[model samples]
Target: MTGQLTVTVGKSDGRVTVLTLSGELDRDETHLLEEAGEAALASGIQLLVLDLRSVTFCDSSGLRTFVHLHRLATARGACLRLAELHPPVSTVVEVVNLDRMLSLHPTVADALIL
Candidate 1:
């Protein structure tokens, strides 16, 4: 379904930048997701915690976007972690075996602790 991805950035104990992603993250919404991460880095946000609980769907493009952003964070000596993925999104994450390459937390709170 058509939807929007809203990114809200916050500070986690003055150490990391928490980027909470809400709404569906599909092909149509993936570009915004990529820009959100890049913007965080550009704004000096090192550590990134992506809360995906509100994301109802994520296609290959969305996953690819995440991977690209993850690499960007790594290059900047930062980390990009995901948390609170809905069941559908989580299933795709598992199907793609992204769990093996990326850290997935149960919740945004948990991601912050990582």
Candidate 2:
């Protein structure tokens, strides 16, 4: 059985926006993340932070969504950062070396400051 994904707007100021995600991020749930990310980018925020401490699992589809969001943020002249990755999600990102390609932080506060 697939776990349900939940995306929540954790913070949204004029320049920075943070989206908190929980549950498994798989093929079936990528769209929820994509939509939330796109909306955050469209709002002209200079920085987009994804807080993934609650996300328990992630698949290739989640990686694709991250890349997609990165590109979108770049095209819109914004920055994307992922924060507080759980072990399962962090393992996937590290094994694939996506950690080198994406901005990652130990905490949402860290992402916000840097």
Candidate 3:
């Protein structure tokens, strides 16, 4: 709520990186997401899962971060999938139709399988 953010990186069953995000995602916090994604890509992780179930808020900067990550991942022959976006974040994704542009799953398990 106060623009705070946290990112937890973990490995799923497959060779995928799962980033669990909590709290607000905005200009002040997007760096965390960017760093996690970039590090995963740099480390040769082709598949990424972003679990945003605990996210409380997100701004345009957060959206931009996601879009940029998607592009970077693609260029690196990687993929970024999002899962469990909170209501606020989900609304923004839906309004911008990013739900169509990005691979979105209802759960982390679902993203990991795909």
Best candidate according to lDDT: 2
Choose 1 or 2, whichever is better by lDDT: 2
Candidate lDDT (C-alpha), each: 0.81, 0.95, 0.89
lDDT tens digits by residue: candidate 1, 1-114 = 578878777564445878777888888888888887887776666578888878878888888988898889888888889988878999998999998888888977888764
The residue-by-residue lDDT of candidate 3 on 29-102, one tens digit each, is 99999998898888877798899999999989999999999999999898999999869999999999999999
Higher-lDDT candidate of 1 and 3: 3
Error of 1 at 14 (Å): 6.2
Question: By TM-score, is 2 or 3 better?
Answer: 2
Tens digit per residue, CA lDDT, model 2, 1-114 = 278999999999889999999999999998999999999999999999999999999999999999999999999999999999979899999999999999999999999984
| Distance from true location, Cα of 52 in model 1, Å | 0.5
Better of 2 and 3 by lDDT: 2
Report the Cα lDDT for residue 28, model 2.
93
Model number with the top TM-score: 2
- In model 3, the runs with Cα more than 4 Å from the true position are 12-14
Sort by lDDT, top down from the best: 2, 3, 1
Candidates in order, TM-scores: namely 0.88, 0.97, 0.93
